[model samples]
Target: MKSSHILLLLSLASTGAAAFELGAPKNNNTDNLVWTGHLSPDTDSVTSALIAAHIYGGTAVVPEGINPESQFVLDYCQIAAPKPLNDFSQKAVGLVDFNQKTQLHPTIDESSIVAIVDHHAIGGAPVNMTQVTPIDIRAWGSAATILADRAESLDIDLPAHLACTTLAGILSDTVVFQSSTTTEYDRYYAKELAKEAGIVDLKAFGQKMLEAKSDLSHISAAEILTMDYKNFSYGGKKVGIGVAETLTAQQLLDRRNEFVAAMISYKETQKLDHLFFAVIDTKNKRANLLWIDDIDAAIAAKAFTGQPKQGWLVLDGVTSRKRQIGPAIQGAIEGKK
Candidate 1:
C-alpha cells in the first residue's frame, strides 16, 4: 500500500470508521462475515454488498430478491447474485447502502452487526457497536463508491466483473450522475471503475442499465410500487415513498388507475400517514407523482413544486426522489403543526 493511502486508512481509524483491515481476519477469527444491504435490494444495495464482502472477507447476502436493474447488471457482468438471508440472527454481519432500523431485517440482532459502510444518513443504527467495529458512513452518492475507494487505496485490484458491477451500482444510485445526490467521490470513482471495467462509453452503459430498469411491463402495480420503495418517519408520521424510472413515462401513466388503486391499498395496508409515488422519465428528466386520493394529493402538494395535470403531479426536470422528493416530503411533514 502507498504511504498516502496508508495514512488515509490511519485517518479513518482515528475517526469512528476505523474497522477496516486488509490481509487476514482480525484476531485470526475463522468465522465468515456476512454482508447485506437494505430490505428492497436495488442495484446499489446488492452491488455494494458484493463489493463489501469481496473487499472485507465475507459472503454477500440480500434481504430480499434484487430489482431488474440489479439482476441485469449482475447478469451482464456474469456475476452471481448474493443468496437471500431470511434471518440474520447471531450472524457476524456488515451493512451497506442503508443504516436504518426500518430497513433492516426483522430478525436481525443489533449485536450481530460487525461493520457498516453506507452513504445515507445515520438514523436508528445500532448504538452498542463494538469498539473495533468498522463504521464508514459518508455523504457520497453510493456505498459502492466508498468500498471501491478502499479497494483503490489498499491497492487491491478488483476483478473485472466486480469492477463492472461496482460501476453499475454507482451509476444506478446516482442516476448516471443526473441525480442531485451525486458527489465528487461518485464521479471520480465512476470514471475509475469504468476504466477498470473496460467500458468505453460510461453514458452508453448507463443507458443500457436504465433500459433494463425501465422494462417494468410484466410487474404488478403493487410490485412496481414496492420494488424501489422505502418507508420513512417524519415528525411521528409514517411515510412510504416509491419511485419508478422509465424511458416511457407515458406507458406507466397509462396505468394510472391501477397505480392509484395500488397506492390506496398500500397506504391502508401499511397504515401509512402519507404515501407518494413518482414515475420518473429517465430520458426527459421529469416526474409524474401519483397519489391515492384527495387527502394524499393535498399533502403531496405541499412538498413539491409540481402542479396537478391529468391526475398526476407533474414535476418538470425533477428526476430525483432521494434528493428532491424524499427531503421535500420530510420537510413538509415536519413543518406541519
Candidate 2:
C-alpha cells in the first residue's frame, strides 16, 4: 500500500474502534499525571468521583458552586466518598482555581481534566486539547443526568452510593423534573440512575431532595444571592446579577420581601453596570423582573417603561433567562446610543 493509503487506513480503523464509554478514564498512561477532576453534576459527585480516581492514583478537583463562600462539605448531608468526610476535609483539597486575573482557558491545561459534563450554558470557549478527554454539556434538566448517562454508556458499574448523589443533583436541578428545562432524556436518566443507585422509588428520592433544598429557613439572604449569582458582559459593559425564585407562586409570594432585599443588597455590593433579578413563577410561566439600580437604563428607549410596581415587573411567558431575559437584555444593550 502507498504511504498515504496506509495512514488513511490507520485513521479509519481508529475512528471505527472508538467506543462510547461514559465514566471510564481516557489515556491510562499515568506517569507524571497526578489528578483529574470530573467537573459537572454536583460538587459532591465530582468530589466523590475524584476521590475514587485519586485512590487508584490521581487527584480530583471539581468546580466550586456559583459563589462558593463556605468550605466544601464533601460527605456532608449524607454524601459518600472513598474516605470519610472528615478525612477528605483534613487533606488539602484541590480547586479549579480561576480568578479575575487568571485566564480561564489556560487553567485547565495544568492538570488532566478527565471528563467535563455540565448542564449550564457553556460560559466561554476554552483552549488546550492535549488532554481534553471527554466533554458533555447538556442544556436540559441537570448535569447529574449527563453523568449518569456517562456511567451507563461506559458500562461502568455505578455503586449505590454514587447513584444517590447523582439522583440528588438531578432532583435539585430539575426540581423533580417539574422545571421547564426538564425533558424526556432527563426523566429517562433519572429513572435509570435511581435504579442503579438502589433507590426503589425515584419519585420519593426526588421529593426528599427537593425538601432538603427547600428548607431555606436557615439560609440567609446573602447566601441565597450567592447561590444563583452570574456575571455576563454585554453592550461594552459588564453586568453582575443574581436570580432567586421559588418553584411555586405561593413560595415566591411568601419570600417576596426577602428576595427584594437580597437583590438590592447584591446590586450595591457587586457594583455592576446593571443589576437585575428575575423572580420566576415557574408554575404560572410568569416572571417578575426586579430592577435594583437601573430601571431607567433597562427601559430607557425600550417599549417597556415606567417604574415596576413594587419592584416587580410582570413578564408574561418570559421565565427563562436563556430564552427571554438574556436576549432582551442584549437587545436593549445593543440598541443603546
Candidate 3:
C-alpha cells in the first residue's frame, strides 16, 4: 500500500465513530505486517495480538468486535486500540486467539500467516505449508499466558496498563481461575502480570472486570449471540456455538422468547445445522443453555448431560466451552452418525 493509503487506513482505524466495523478496505498494500485476533475479540485475543505485535514488530489490529471488558481496559489504561481488520490478503499476518478459518476474515490469505498463537481448536488441516512458524496452540486457559511467558523471559518492560490489559485476558478466559483449563502457569503469570500492572487484589479486579462486561442493556439477543460466538465443523456438519457470560442469568431468562426468536432467525440466515447459545452465570458457576427447538435442546442435553428446565439447560460445573461444550457437542453428533 502507498503511504497515502496507509495514512487513510490508520486514520479510519483511529478516528471513525464505527471504525471497528468497517471490515478491511480493498486494494491495499501487502508489504505491511499485522497481528490480528479473532472475530468478536475477547481479552485474551486482543491482548495476545497486542503483545505479539510488539514482540514480532507488527501492528496489532482489532477483529470485527471488541468485548465490553476489553474496551473498558483500553479506556482505563488510556490505550489507543488498533483499528479493526477486514482483509488480510497479500499483507503479512499473524493470528492470535483462534486459528480456525471460519473465525478469520474470509479475505485473509492463510498462506500469508507467519505465526499463530492460540489455545482453541485448529482450523481444518493445512494443505501444503511454507512458513507457519511459532504455531503455538495448546490446551492452556489463555493465549495471553503464552505471550506473558515470552515477555517475562525477555525481561521486557510493559507499557502502562499493558500488563493489566493482558491479565484481563487470562482472567476472563480462565473464568477468574475457576476454569478446568486453568494451569499452574496461568496462575503464576497472573501474579507476575499483576505486579507489573500494580494490581493489589486479583480476584477483586477480576470481578470488577466481569461486572463491567455483564451489561446487557441496549443490546438485542441477536447481538448478544454474535458478540462472542464460535463456529465449528464436525463430520461435515456446521455448528455455531455462542457463549455469553454474565453474572445474572435471570435477567437473560426474562427475555426467553426474544432469545428463541432471535436464534431461529439466526439459524435460518446462517444456514446452520446446529445452533445454540449459553448464558453463563459466572458469579454462581452455572449456565442456562438456550435453544430454538426440541432437537437442539436434546442435543444440548446429550452434549453436556444437563437437564433442561423451561427450555433452558441448567449446566453446573461447566465453565470453559472449549473443554466442556465443544467436545461434548462433537461427541453427540458423532454418536448419532
TM-score on alpha carbons, each prediction: 0.89, 0.64, 0.87
**Cα lDDT of model 2 by residue, 156-234, tens digit:** 6666665666665666556676666777777877787678767788877655544444445567766765555556566
lDDT of 3 by residue, 1-337 (tens): 0011111112211221222111222222324879888777777888888887666566899867687878887786567777887766667777788877667777777566656677776533231224324466666789898777767655567875788878888998998998889988789888988888888898888988788778887689889888888877766778888988888778887888988889899999989988988888887888788778777766766777677678788888887778877788878877752
**Highest TM-score model number:** 1
C-alpha lDDT of residue 310 in model 2:
57
What is the C-alpha local distance difference test score of each model?
Answer: 0.81, 0.48, 0.74
Which RMSD values do the candidates have, in order?
Answer: 4.0, 8.7, 9.6
Judged by whole-model lDDT over C-alpha atoms, candidate 2 comes out at 0.48
| C-alpha positional error of residue 239 in candidate 2 after TM-score superposition, expressed in Å | 2.5
Task: State, as a TM-score between 0 and 1, how close model 3 is to the true structure.
Answer: 0.87
- Most lDDT-accurate candidate: 1
The candidates, ranked best first by TM-score, are: 1, 3, 2
Better of 1 and 2 by TM-score: 1
Model 1 residue 286 lDDT score:
90
Rank the models by lDDT, top first: 1, 3, 2
